[model samples]
Target: MEYYEVLENFGQLALACVLGGMIGYERQSRRKSAGLRTNILVCLGSCLIMMMSYEIYKQVEGMTNADPARLGAQVVSGIGFLGAGAIMKEGVSVTGLTTAACLWVVACVGLAVGAGFYIEAIMTTILVVIVVGVLSHFELKKSTRAGVLQLTVYSDNNPEQLSIITSCLDDLHIDITKIKMREEYARNEREQTIILVMEMMLLNSRHYSTTHIVNILQDLPGIHGIELR
Candidate 1:
């Protein structure tokens, strides 16, 4: 490659680093699993692959049928596996989907940089940052309004008590995401008590409030206390 060509490639790589790092920093600040280094590597690798593809096409130019996009197309499809690794399932809640998507988009941005689409790459980076950073606050606010309820319930060690609580939640149309139970011996009362911690989300159609949940549960027999978080 000519000296000028080498410098151009270097510039593209540097731009990829900056653009990818912008998104990565946001993810890192949010404590996401795919952050900083991961994003940078994905972007830089994709950029290099695209550049190689272009160079190969140039070298083989009239000698054979060469597609500069062939390698980039592979990168687009192959990146899915890396993105899939970022996703996680916990109980009924799935997390890291956004991180996975971020990885995929960052790879595309890198390809754009490598293809000399500097304007497009920079614009994409800005839009992605806004979506993941500024727009996330709105998403959070909406989620808070929708209400994911965490409740700690203390009750006598009776299976029926647990059943009743679950049934009540079902009746209220609460979508229970997770439940954890542990038995503890009450030193003073000389009886075994069950501590149930529940994480649930209230359906949008349901109008039940936290206070209503507490009141309903408190009236149930064998229930000692209910705490909401």
Candidate 2:
């Protein structure tokens, strides 16, 4: 427990906090739930645990039972629970996976700092920031290939059917951009029919075809015909 040793350990903790905060800053700027304070605390706590493990190893010198890396191994696997907390499922769309992953990596960065792997820790922080910041736009652009789907539906004027259709669209992760409804009088049946035109943004359009959506809507009661434009 020399003064220099204490300084070194303190410096490592500081580095871990800084690196973790940088990653969290990116997430915070994007309005993510787990941001600055959360990341910093996780990193600092991990670093402290690792530092204690290292000190224990030094104290138990010449002992065959000591393992300096044992605590760090636990940190690696134990971080999963924290990461899982960051994930959220909304309808068919899942969010916060990237944030969870970032937290996991930040934990690793903290361990690296505690182990005196400064270079590796710094490099990993930079890479995480680049992936989270720069690559996200490209990923969004790539998924927009399917773009928007425009559809017109002919059905009976039933509010229940309309509710079912909207619910199905939400489950499909389809965002309704615009919707227009007009009433039509059927000459043969004397019943009122509804004509609905909708513009929707498909989240996973590659997996869902126009025909697939039409088939799904056809199953709902009161839907007579569906036309994809």
Q: Which lDDT tens digits does candidate 1 get at residues 46-94?
A: 9999999988988899866688999999999999999999888763367
Cα deviation at 229, candidate 2, in Å, is 16
- TM value for model 2: 0.68
Which pairs clash in model 1?
none
Model 1 segments more than 4 A misplaced: 145-148, 152-197, 201-208, 215-227
**Model 2 lDDT per residue over 59-138, tens place:** 99899989999999999899999999999874334678998998889889999999889999999999999999999888
What's the C-alpha lDDT at position 79 in model 1?
94
Would you estimate the TM-scores of all the predictions? 0.76, 0.68
